[model samples]
Target: MNTTTLLFEAPGPRGRRRCRLFEIISWAVLAGIAYLVIQTLDKRGAFDAAAWQPLGQLGVWRQLGVGLLNNVRAAVVGMLLSMFFGCFLGWGLLSGHKIVRYPCRAFTDLFNGIPVLLLLFFTSLALPAWGLPLTDFWFLVIALSLYSTAVIADLVRAGVQALPRGESEAAAALGFSGLQSMWLILLPQALRMMSPALVSQMVIVFKGTTLAFVLGGYFDLLRAATVLGAYYSRSLLQAQGIAAVAFMLINIALSQTAAAIDRRERRRYGVPPIGTGSRSPGMPE
Candidate 1:
């Protein structure tokens, strides 16, 4: 039996039958919903071949692909910025000095709590209004960076917190300065431990690229789809559907990568992989 079975009783034969019944019912309900949706969309001529014609045009895809590249660029730049600032902010949160701690806490709480769209407005519009005009590209990137940094800060702090207390104590005993210890010892290990969370957060950053549509300066994938829809009204639904599919595929890839990293970390750290019956020493049977 696996650890899960040891932890909780497995269902009996009758329970399996009930589960099968539930599965069937769920599928039936979903099929009914799908049929209803298809009928409604058909009434609106959404399934007409003309409406989907734009998807066949090479130019439409080329435009969307360019926009997709922009989305990737923004996500990459923004995520890098977040990682950089978040490392310092994470250190600030953990610092002994009140001067560092208070400011980091305030910044983390402030941005983490605010809606990202508001930040986009501030970066893309408010700054320009105040005579700090930034390109739409920078605006989107900066907004994503600001919004995601707080989350990355929490990830860093959590990684550090998860380390054995002796790690820091050992550094102190070796006559190392605080910064030296962090740079030479603590950060490397902490980053490895938190790699999975950090990778998962990249998915969030990538998804946030869609918010560029509201700010109107950046030409993210969603914005491209919007323009295509406006120019070809009949293709609106198809364009949106395609964009949704693209997002789903990318997010799935990111999620799978995170899961793989998590598995690797578990093995490297000597934790029993999920579904294995093996348990660590002192784990209750």
Candidate 2:
């Protein structure tokens, strides 16, 4: 075998030429598209310096800060609630009793199937008619929590179910109750194994806070941008671009933190580098 073929099957000379041609064509197409977009935006005054001047104002910065705080508050509350309730529902779904498990399973399926926007609308609008008068802040949090609860419940369930059967059996042999074994042995391991996924869900929860703009009462970053745009006499493009940068910075930080934690966890557990599947002996068959 050729030294060059050690890592993978070597491409023939014609195949290599074809690959080079494809790469060149793809880059050229992408560059052309980018140039067109930049040109169009420039023509539309999206790059105007005057429109972005308001971003330097103290009052404008304060408004953005308040909006960001509201978003953070809702996301944090929802994430905590989701983790708590999701864990309970996940454990219930794995219970031996059909009465406990079936209801949890049904609720998970129902909520998970519903769109997040619909959930937010239902909580914000319909709930008041149903005699639950919630403020927009609470409504947003509840809506996000409800949707994330279903998703996190499924993640928890999969995490727990992925454990080896012997772990449970050994606990039973040691005279531990099923619940005790789950609490003492299984839940902790499952949580560690699923930490990366839970962090991802938290990021989703935070991003979903943007949809609170539809509620009218919630003053999130997007809503703030819209208000600023109106005040600046049709500077919507500039305000929106600033808002986009804020979101990009925040979500990028969150994603990087999550990735770092995941890498550390994988290293600690000696998991594979690509990290999709488990290499641990304790994992389920």
> What are the lDDT scores of the predictions, listed in order?
0.86, 0.85
Best by lDDT: 1
Q: Give per-residue CA lDDT, model 2, range 191-285, as digits (tens).
A: 88788778778889999999999989989989998998899854788778878888888888888877887787777876522223434434443
Clashing pairs in 2: none
C-alpha lDDT of residue 236 in model 1: 90
lDDT value for model 2: 0.85
Off by over 4 Å in 2: 1-16, 173-175, 272-285
TM-score of each: 0.88, 0.86
Give a tens-digit lDDT track for model 1, residues 111-220. 99988889998888788998988898989998999989999887778778768899989999999899988778887788787877888889999999998888776788
Over the full model, what C-alpha lDDT does candidate 1 score relative to the true structure? 0.86
Off by over 4 Å in 1: 5-22, 272-285
At residue 164, what lDDT does model 1 achieve?
A: 84
